[model samples]
Target: MTESSPTVWGVGTTRTLRAHWALAEAGVAYETKPIQSRSGETQTDGYAALNPKQKIPFLEHGDVKISESYAIVDYVFEVFGGDRVYRPATSAERAASNEWCSTILMELDAHTLYVMRRHGDLKDLYGAAPAAIDAAKEYFTKLADAMVMKLPAGPTCLLSEKISVADILLMSCLDWAVLYQVPVPEAYGDYRKRMSERPAYQQAFDFNFEVLGVTHKDLPR
Candidate 1:
């Protein structure tokens, strides 16, 4: 750790994956506080102040404490995000970036989390719902098809050029999906392979698995 390193309080399996990868991309120094909230420590009084939702991925930049994955990423981009090239250099590019990021959350992550929170190994951490699990898997199949068509490629999409927060968000969700054993539609196989090939993606994936203590059977709760 150094004076420039940002201090981040991250819980297991949280969106901190995105923040961690972003820091790595920006070549920024940072420390992980590891809230260790596996037993609900985040609900405790002290930790609650850092996040209204008592969530993981709370970041402390000097005196400026922040919460939420997107907000934290936006802040990082605004301050230490360097030249706009990493995300979008112009208004239209940024808008496109936002579109891709939204697609990851609204379509990809939502459905995947449902499966994890319902079936898979998440029951050990947050209980289970079979219906939710089924629906989640079902939903993701559609998303996979849509992604296969859009596929975040070409000069306009995030993966087409340089990796961006959009790629980080999508890749993080896909990594979780693999751990959960949710069927990855055949269409997404190529996309997954592309993301896996990136060095930054690999770094984040290894760190996430190591920190979460996961094997093939484990899914983040």
Candidate 2:
């Protein structure tokens, strides 16, 4: 890819979808490397040179290279979104946005859903831990119970009318949790439906999931 081109590495995971979705929302066109985790793609010499950590959902734009889906989404919003996307304009607004992002990542993703992912679907590689998976599922439901209250009636978003980086992170996690049968909050169903109906989300979903026979329906297992 050229230096000015924005390129995203990896596909077939919620994390990868986050990057793709963010780019779409920001109205930035990018190239996809179409790499999958643990398929000997990230282990290649070329990918090793790009990211020593060998993780998917890495970003390359101009001279900047970014790892982590959350960071990439934040960067895309800051750099490319202009007024097309809503970005926190004040310190307090930023704090509020950060609060949503942090809680979603820690509580919904790493702390619960990811634990279930490692022990459940990926059991062959990570080794099944039924107790851990059960605990994770229970933890997810517990978090959802409290989190549902934070959501507003009708259509919902962390930020009222405008979608923010936090919403993208949340949509990705909610979908992942549902795939794992983690009992995601029912209140979020309509919220997710509305967000998924966005043209940008549809674009990203098609690119990330509709490659050949692979689809989001076949994911997480």
Score each candidate by Cα lDDT: 0.68, 0.82
What clash pairs does model 1 have? none
Q: How far is candidate 1 from the true structure (C-alpha RMSD, Å)?
A: 3.9
Backbone clash pairs in model 1 (N, Cα, C under 3 Å; residues 3+ apart or in different chains), count = 0
TM-score of each: 0.80, 0.91
Report residue 21 deviation for candidate 2 (angstroms): 0.6
What is the lDDT, from 0 to 100, of the residue 40 in candidate 2?
92
Clashing residue pairs for model 2: none
Off by over 4 Å in 2: 153-156, 212-221
Question: How far does residue 15 in candidate 1 sit from its true spot (Å)?
Answer: 1.9
Model 2 lDDT, residue 43, Cα: 93
Per-candidate total of colliding backbone pairs: 0, 0
Candidate 1 lDDT by residue in tens digits, 50-112: 778887788888788888787777677667767632657688877877877887787777656
lDDT of 2 by residue, 19-83 (tens): 99988888876788999887899998999999998998999997899989999999998898777
In model 2, the Cα lDDT at residue 100 comes to 78
RMSD (Å) of each candidate, 1 decimal: 3.9, 2.6
